[model samples]
Every structure is written in C-alpha cells, then in structure tokens.
Target chain A: MLRSQFHIELNNMHVELDKMCHLVIEAIDRCVEAFQNHDLELAQEIIRNDKAINDVERSVESKCLSLILKQQPVASDLRDVSTALKVVTDLERIGDQSADIAELILEMDEKDSYLMIEHIPSMARVAIEMVTSALSAFHEHDIQKANEVKKHDREMDQLFEEVKLELVQIVKENKDHVDLAIQFLMIAKYFERIGDHVVNICEWVEFNQTGKVNDTRLI
Target chain B: MENKIVAKNVNLHYGSKHALKNVSLDIKENAITAFIGPSGCGKSTFLKTLNRMNDYVENCKIEGTILLDGEDVYDEKVDTTVLRKKVGMVFQQPNPFPMSIYDNIAYGPRIHGIKNKRELDRIVEESLKAAALYDEVSDRLHTSALGLSGGQQQRLCIARALAVQPDVILLDEPTSALDPISTLKIEELLLDLKDKYTIAIVTHNMQQASRIADYTAFFLVGEMIEYGQTKDIFSIPKDKRTEDYITGRFG
Candidate 1:
C-alpha cells in the first residue's frame, strides 16, 4: 500500500477517536456543572445520560480492533491506535465517576449545603478544565500540553485538600450540618479524582505520539 | 555455530524499486535465524537472496557480496545451481512432487548423480528421520506424495530438501498452512535440526520467531531495522519500529 493511504487511514482513525474523547469530556463537564448548581433535575438528567458515553467508548474500541485486524498497522500508527483505545477507557471511567457524583448530588435534598466552601466550585471547574484540555492535547498530539496537564493535577489535589479541610471544620462547628458537609467533600474528591484520571489519559496520548511513558507523579 | 553465510552492505532491487537497503547479516552454521516483519517488507526477499533464488526472477538485481564459507556465492564463477544445492529452501506452501514419497526424497540424490539403490534407501531413511517423519511414513514410502495430510506433506518437502544434503536450509513461512500441533512439530524440528544444519526462516508470527529463533532480525520497509538475540529483540528491541511491531502496537 502507498504511504499516503496509510497516513490517511490513520488520520481518519485519530479524528474519530478525538470526537469520542470530546463527547466523554462533555458528559463529565455537564455532570460536574449540574452538581455544582444544586440542580437535582439537571443532575438526574446527567446521570441518565451515560449511555451516550458508553456508546462512544464501544465504537472507539471496536474501531481500534478492526484497524488492528484489518490494516495490520505498523510502527507509530499501531501505537497511536492502541493508546487511543486505552485513553478512551480512562475517559469512560471518568464519565462514570461524573455520573456517580451527579447521582449523589440528586440524592442530597439540601440546596444550601454547597455554599460552605468557596473552593469546591473552583475545584469542579478546574477538574473539568483539566479533562477538556488533556483531551485537546491528545487530539493535537501536543506533548507540552500533556505535561502541563500532569502538572495541573497537583493544583487539583491542593484544591481537594483545602476543600476537605474546610468541610471538616464546618462539620465540627455544627454537628447538625455534618452529613451535608461530608457529601460535598465527597463530591469534591470525585472531581479531583477525575482530574487525575484525565492526566493519565494525557500520559497515554504522549506515549502514543512518542513511545515514552512520561514519569509524572499523580500528586 | 560459525558464520556460514555473511551478507555485508547488500542491496537488492526489483526494476526501479529498492527491496533491500544495505542489509548486512550473518547466517551462523548450526543455528536458526528468523527474519520477522510485515508483508512486503522484504523478509522473504532477503531470505531468497541467501541461496540466490532471486536469479529466477527477471529484472531482480543485487549489489555487494554474499559470502558462503568465505567464498563469494554471487561471484561469476560460482554456479547458482550448485549454490542452491548447498542452500535448500522450504516454501510457505508445501510443494511436494507428484511422484511417490520415496522418489521425492531420492530425487535430489539422483540429480546429484547417486544411482545406487542401497545409497538411495539410506538417504531416504536418513532424510525422513532428520525431518522427524521417518517412523510415521517409513511404511508408506511407496505412497504418492499428494496423498499425505498438509502437515505430513510439508514434512515430506522438508525431507526432500534434507535429502539434497544442503549445508544451509531456508524456510519461508514453512508451517503457515499447518495446524497448531503441526506448527509445534515443525518448530521442534527446526530447533533439533539447527545442531546439524544452518537454518534461516522468515515468519510473520512474532511468537513463533520468539519461540524458535536464536538470532532475530526485524525488517521494516525493506530495511533491516534491528538484529540481535531473539530475547532482546522481543522483550526490548533497540529500535522503536521493532518494538512497536513486535508488541502488537502495529504490524
């Protein structure tokens, strides 16, 4: 086969993979947004909307399998597709975690419980932003952005720590609000974890682009 | 095993297309060497060069020297017919002769001017035994070669090659048409035969190459990208292309 044909096939695969990653990131963003707004209806909608992400995951995985069995791609094209499949798996898990957080938010009846911490909303925002940027970096094959996202995971960890400490103080000050504070803390922890997972996805992308798994600490 | 065939800065071309680019490798005597790569990467073409099988194809040309026992096999005075007798080949498909099994094994010795009946019988027995098919087919030596099963047919072809008393054997995907048991038998035979004859095989199966090869050479787009011990090439190939290919990251 011609080299041009090979490149075209690989480029097409990468494009479709990027689109799937975008859908997963969008789902995660919506779930986090719904929880932060204390909108039970929106949170429930996000929780029920998980099937789209699942569909995308299955499609991307099968595409990678077909590429392997049919094209018998070699060298970098093989690494790229294999890593894309793994990264989508991480994205799927992130989507699941987002849905889980959304379900928890819908179960919590208290609306003002989220106002305890100024950092919790920022934490969610930063986490989603990290996820979105990491995926973008993967689509662009930007190693610098991948490394930057890994470094940003530390900020998400700091936000998680600060929010957890603040929530503990709030629970101690008023034992009546302990349950609500704990629930919000748990939500913050999930978002922080989502950030870490996205960073992992970025690391896989970097490895696909350049066959070296970056040694970045998760923090 | 000593180096029996050495290719230094060898380049091959088919008309305008370059098939091998400065490929340099040593085929050791009494050892099995595997050539592994995706199709159209010149692994099979490179294997054919060892015995000058490419001479049959028009417009195929080779540069540099291929030395067999310190003598240039491609020299003007070196007859390709005699070189082929020294380096026998087994192809992907079992191409057994239409004659009887005994005749198939005896054909090579007869072509080389061995006419004694006692010598022919000995050569057939020894060759079949060398291919690990002597006991299975010793009673059926008079049977037609085409009547055997696929695996048995492949073994028969191997025995036919062995009967020629070639110093080097070239197998190009020899077990590709056989079942798992047959593949294992051929692989085992290759391992055992390496102690007596120098062997070079080209295979698409990485697992098979890792399993049976002592030295492995990885090719990509007509270039010999990596050559080393089989374990090192499989576990940690020095080249990124080789690692990617072997690890199922690509073809």
Candidate 2:
C-alpha cells in the first residue's frame, strides 16, 4: 500500500485540491455577502479573487500532469488524478459564476430594500453548501454523500423556478420595481448555474470513487 | 474482417512448466493484432504455436488446435515448411543471414523453388520495395546484409519475409532493437503492409500496440486475461489485471 514517492505526491495533490476548494468557497461566500449588503467594495473584492482561483486551477492541472507522467498512476490512483483534472475545471467555473453574480450586483443600482430578494440568500446558501458537501464527499470517497449533493441541486433548481415565478408576479404587480426584479432573477440564475457546477463536481466525485463519470448524474 | 487464423483452447508446457493456459483467439485478416504482456507471460510462446516454431524444443508438449484458413495446422498431414512460409517470423534482433542483401531477400524465394536469376532479381526488388527498404539498399543488392545499420538489417529481415509471399507475418519485438526513427519507419511500413497481409506482433511496449494494432490481447502469468479492440483495452480494460498491467502498476 505504501508506494513511497508516489503515495506522498498523491497526498500532496490532495492537499492542493483542498486549497482550491477553500478559494472557491471563499469566492461564493464573498459574492453572496456583497450582494446581500449591496456593498460595491466587497463586490469588487470578489471580482479580484477570481484571479486567485484561476491561478490555483492552473497549478492543480500541471501538478496532475506531472503525477500522471512521473507516477504512471492506474486504476483507482489513475481515477484520483484524472478526476482531479476534471474537478478543477468545475471548481474554477464556480468561482467565475460567483464573480459574474458580483458583477451583476454592481449593475443593480441601489435598492435599499427589495421584496423578492428573500429567496436569493437561500439559493446562495444552498449553492455553497452543495459545493462544500460535494468536496467533502470527494475527499471522503463517499458516493452516497455525493449523490446527496446532487439531490440538493434539485432543491436549488426548484428555488430558482420559484424566484422566476415571484419575479414574474412582481413585474406584473408594479412596473416601477420591474428592473429590480429582473436583476434578482439574474442573480438567482447565476446561483442555479453555480449549483449545477456543484452537481458536476459530485459527478466527478463518482468518477474518483468508482472510475465512472456517470452521465445520468450530470446536470 | 475475416479471421486469417484461429487458436482454440491452446495450452503448452515446457517440462512441467505450464507456459500457456487455454489461449484462444482469432487473428483477423489484413489487420495487425498485438500480443502484449510482461516477459515469460507466454506471448512469444503463443506466437510460436501459430507456426509450429515450438516443435524443435526438447520436452515441449502442446495441447490445442490451431487453424489457418480452417485447415488444422497441427494435423500430421500438414507441412511445417509450408506453414512457416505462410507465417514468416521476425525476431527481437535484426537477424539477416550472413550473405549479400539480395541473397537475404532471395533466400525464401529460392527455398520455395525460384531458381531463375531475372525472376530472383524481380522478387528481391519488389520485396525490398514492399518492406520500404528498396530506395536505401537497391544499389547495394550485392553488399553484405551484415554491413547495413541495425534498422536497415531489420527491414531487410522484413523484406526477406515478404519474399516468401506469406499470408501472415509474425513480428516479435521487431523494433525493440532499432532506433526511434527506424521504429517509426517500420511502424509506418507495417501500416502499409496490413493492406495486403495479416500481421501479428508481440511487443512489450503498450504505446506501440495502442498506436498500430486493431485488436490487442493482454496476457499475464500464462493466461489470456483480456482481448478486445485496441482503444477499449487501453482506455477501459474489463479485467483488473489487464488494467493494472497496461497502467504499469503490475510487476
């Protein structure tokens, strides 16, 4: 079981993956916080940190390539390395969507208070939890927990549809607040996409655990 | 594709050492099939069984059926010389006979009863051309085959096989002894040759098999572990042992 240098290198790669997860998690949290408070400075900060996530993504990729070439990993070990390659892309996309949500927040002119903004926070919370749980499932090699993360994405999707219906109601109820409702819908759409990325991460978790990228589990 | 040869439940033992275990496979016509595995895993032993090359070994006993064109090759009435002519083998080393280049290519034809000089010259030219060595060695037909480089000698060996007009060519690690450029040229030549003749190659190199073979059989510990399309074997092997071996995890 102790494969000397290869074992050590794979463990190190796992630690690097945790760091990538941390960066993505932070981006999601910051984007949600800035959107909730309508804080322009914090939104700009979320935009800036996407660069850090991109850097980690590239590093993880090259490290994976090195491990494959040097260690020639196979079977479960190969699946681990290959899934790491795939997971980083989904994680990187999560960071970009968070930044895009932040950018949209910057456009939604000052709304001191909004009626339909209630669901946005829960959608953000669900998206972040799905990502966190999916990463934990990957780290633990838990197929059941990964499947649970996929199930949580459906909740996020339902919340997305609910927000869309509410926005429609608001557009019909008051023409004055139509612009604000549309922005909320865009933010909800971004969160739903981020949740889909989380589902993709869970599917890749299945790939790492079983060496099968289950297409049926795909968003 | 039609099968050029079929091996059914073949087993071999060398003085109580079981070298092959129930090995059966169909070699498709005009396509290259590669046998890949670790050393002493019986890939070479099975390749020999195809042509009865194991008959000379002391204490070697074989149990199996090998059919070439639906004719039982192991039957007492079958002639090994005729079988070998149909199944020409190239070894791990560049083994050109100690003779002129023309003579080396002409050796098989002469053995098959071609005595005319003009006829021999034409076979020599055409065989060398078919082996992709004609341009380099055409002018040196009378020169010593031993005088050529290692790569040239191997190609001459191939040209020698081609002269026999064999239906199936067996290559045993043919490029293991050559340089990279020579290896690539031989690979290219084999690709061209497959359009006319069925070829079975035994190589330790997985990439070489993946690069050239249409079907690959993975052997291990004297057993045929997995056999399938080349892409499937390399990408998603059904057997754990095959996956482990191809991924360089198994010793």
- RMSD, one per candidate, in order: 5.9, 3.5
Give the alpha carbon lDDT tens digit for every residue of B1-251 in model 1: 68999999989999999999999999888988999998999999999988889998899999988999999988999988789899999999999999999999999899999999999999999999999999999889999999998999999989999999999999999999999999999999999999889999999887788889999999998999999888667544679888667755563
> Considering summed lDDT, which 10 consecutive residues are worst modelled in model 2 chain B?
B242-251
How many angstroms is residue A187 displaced in model 1 relative to the true structure, after the best TM-score fit? 0.7
- Score residue B187 of candidate 2 by CA lDDT: 94
Candidate 1, residue A89: Cα displacement in angstroms equals: 1.8
**Retained native contacts per candidate, as fractions?**
0.00, 0.11
Relative to the unseen true structure, what is the Cα RMSD of model 2?
Answer: 3.5
TM-score of each: 0.73, 0.87
Over A51-102, each residue of candidate 2 has an lDDT whose tens digit, in order, gives 9989989988988999988866655667778889999999999999999988
Task: For model 1, state the Cα shift of residue B86 in Å.
Answer: 5.0
Using lDDT as the measure, the top candidate is 2
On residues A92-133, what C-alpha lDDT tens digit does candidate 1 reach at each position?
888788888887887787555565587988887788788888
Candidate 1 global lDDT:
0.84
Candidate 2 lDDT, B1-251, residue by residue in tens: 99999999999999989999999999999999999999999999999999999999999999989999999999999889999999999999999999999999989999899999999999999999999999998788899999999999999999999998999999999999889999999999999999999999999877789889999999887899999888677666788888777765564
